[model samples]
Target: MRDNIILACQTCKHRNYTSTKNKKTLPQKLELKKYCPFCREHTLHKETK
Candidate 1:
């Protein structure tokens, strides 16, 4: 099954579509500095609860 997850940018309200099948999983945890197209820069983000 395809997994659809939401990745929200902490810097701006930029939401990215991430698929578990396509995205690279970090060994430790999610990366802080992610590419944010809305902010036009690399911003930080945390997983939504």
Candidate 2:
């Protein structure tokens, strides 16, 4: 099982990948600083709490 999951950037949906190695604290890095490779921008991802 994973700690959390979410779908961000409806425009470039499923354009990025998230693995078990990608981990971060809530309301901080994980929720605020998700760098979207497709969009080439840092978008706020809604972490499923």
Each prediction's RMSD over C-alphas, in Å, is 4.4, 5.4
In candidate 2, stretches whose alpha carbon ends up further than 4 angstroms from where it belongs are: 15-30
Candidate 1, residues 2-43, lDDT tens digits: the string is: 345566788775666353433355433344568777778788
TM-scores for the candidates: 0.50, 0.37
Assess the local accuracy of residue 29 in candidate 1 as a C-alpha lDDT between 0 and 100. Answer: 34
**Model 1 alpha-carbon drift over 4 Å, by segment:** 1-4, 19-31
Clash list (residue pairs), candidate 2: none
lDDT of 2 by residue, 1-49 (tens): 3454554654466435443314543334343457787788887554432
